[model samples]
Target chain A: MELRRFTQPSATKPTHTTVSNSEIAKWNILDRPLTRSREELYLSTFSFLFAEAVQYLQTRVQQVSELEEKLNQLGYRVGQRALELLCFREKLNRREIRLVSILGFIRVQLWKFLFKKSADYLKKVTDREDEYYIEEEEPLVNRYISVPKDFGQLNCAAFMAGIIRGALDSAGFTASVSAHYIHREEKSRLAFTVTIFMIRLDESVMNRERKLAG
Target chain B: MSSSRASTWNKLGDAAYAKSEKVSADLVALTYGSFVREIIKDFEEPDQVNKELEKLGYNIGIRLIEDFLAKSGISNCSSFEESAEIISRVAFKMFLGIRATVSNWNSEHNSCSIIFDENPLAEYVELPPEYTHSLFYSNLLCGVIRGALEMVQIIVECEFVKDQLRGDDTNEINIRFKEMLQEQVPWNDEE
Candidate 1:
């Protein structure tokens, strides 16, 4: 397949016959196959790449929150693309309409795809109808990262939270997602931090859920 | 003899990669795409973005060489030629799950080109027309090779001579030998 290189002025529209065939491309990107899903790579490759991303973002921002926001935005891009590719690959014909199902889809399907395991916990806030949480004892992004004491309240899992928000927002479920770190200190056992992804659905989504249930 | 050695390295690469922990390639691709996009957004020029990406990869490479050494379990290479072969056949395979071809060697065997048709980092990427002329999308790989070689006492200048992202036939990283450092003991070594 060949795409003609256009050299004409922008003001006038040129036909294929008038345009010069200066360059030829061997393969069209659109013609590439999307069905093959067996692509796997070393975890260390990702870990190295991700660590560099964090360090690069660190130099670009001042505050921890700002750094996280940038990381989230980057992850958001990935999540948006991942959602479309995953849906197409899985051949999921039905769009997720309800709020809970979309959240479930993210917790089970997206989580499994990215992390190789379903999220450790998915729970609804007892007092709030629009709030939910997906907790991971150790997020894959945070595996090799140990937050220094000097840097406070910088959860690298903000990238994961952004991923959740991106997937949710693209699926037409508007929500605000944030990552919170919970330090677990067990007696006679080693201490570890858990990452909780807090997802808060929008009022419109709540109304739609209520209408669907009614 | 060299063919047998290449086959052994291929087998070693396969074994090491199979033994290591793995992740979905899509995640890596998306993350890399996002990282490059972020760099492009922050930097005004494509050349600047390319430099930043290379610096990022250099940092990663210096540290990753340690992991690569531990995983591959090979202590030494007899010559720079041997190192290039191991890099294309073993290191690329063990890390990225793809084996690149090393060719176009100089008569002195001090330089070579590593070529690969399939790039995992570029699986779902199509370079924007605006950035294709000046940007080397995979310049990070060049930095990685340079940094890793520096750690092994073989200082080499590496750069992307060809990139499929720029409508090239294949991705090729050209490496030129510069210097070799003398071995030294640690600063705190006891007499």
Candidate 2:
């Protein structure tokens, strides 16, 4: 029993029809700034939201891998949108045509956009022609998440990998991306865990890269 | 006196917000959008999805209230009106970086509407025609409010009355006060 701002759905106009004619319909999303002028929400807000999402996914899937996959798929959707938004915002009129360039973009621009810092390291696997790695000291997604002992080798950073894959795949660089936690017990004094994203490009994509190089 | 109190809450909200660590808004918005879509895919019905979202928000709210109190240092609201003000000006700004306006108080002052033109959760979100009418895109918020208040002995019913994604000019959530829970003997003491 509150006063409505817009007109009520009348006999002449149905509820659905009014949506197309409304002010919201005319608004364009691309015109909006990618970043807000005001300060962003508390980091814990995102952490809590992410935690809820992981817990919800945990109920549906039987295995840890499946849960990670679900998280990745969700992150993939975000990554696709992030790529478009970042590209537009940065005024990068051109898309990366080569695999290496796209990888650099992910390591630098994409990471900066999401985490406000570039990834720690990017290296090609000397043994494999189509494999590469992007390393982070402690990924933002995994910062507060402490995986239970029973769910061994299940890294929440799979979501971050999915984001990377989504960006790469959208840029015409097909790759299978997964996240792994690299144990550094052998090192003398490494305090924090390191997450490495293993990106394996498809043979076809590698072929194209070689032809482009020629 | 009321205006001064409002500004004081705003300052508290701002100070609390500044003290907390922050992340990009788009990251939260996009992740939320993806999560909602996943729920819709799994639930396959708008009503069910709304229910699921609300349930999830409730779980978050109960836990989040402790963090809110500890960080904001906010304590006992003298009245429901003051609580509403804190929720709008302080809580929303502290967590979501947005300020909602409280209005349309009923005669008994037990019910009111919280309105905000901008929602960070709905950033770049365009609801499909099928969902525009049936779905409350941000139904999670209603649950969060209800659950958070419940932790403080305030039982209230919260529901989204209007959603901007549903073609409304702004998002409005109407909250009605229910009976305050009376103190009861602790379960441990009963034994």
As a whole number from 0 to 100, the lDDT of residue A72 in candidate 1 is 91
Residue B62 displacement in candidate 2 (angstroms): 0.7
Which numbered prediction scores highest in lDDT against the true structure? 2
> For residues B77-113, what per-residue lDDT tens digits would candidate 1 score against the true structure?
6577888999988899988898998999999878899
lDDT of 2 by residue, B51-152 (tens): 999999999999889889998868875567788889999899999998899999999999999988788898888888999899998999998998888888
TM-score of chain B of each: 0.95, 0.94
Q: Write the per-residue lDDT of candidate 2 for residues A1-214, one digit (tens) a residue.
A: 4665466757756456444323543466554555543437798889989999999999999999899899889889988888987887688998799888899999999988888789999999999999999999889988789999999999998999999988888888888899998866646675656999999999999999899999
Model 1's CAPRI class is acceptable
Lowest lDDT block of 10, candidate 2 chain A: A17-26
Q: Give one digit per residue, the lDDT tens place, for model 1 in A3-23.
A: 345454566765566321112
For model 1 the local lDDT of residue A153 reads 85
How well does candidate 1 score on lDDT at residue B156? 89
- Alpha carbon lDDT of residue B188, candidate 2? 94
Name the docking class for model 2.
acceptable
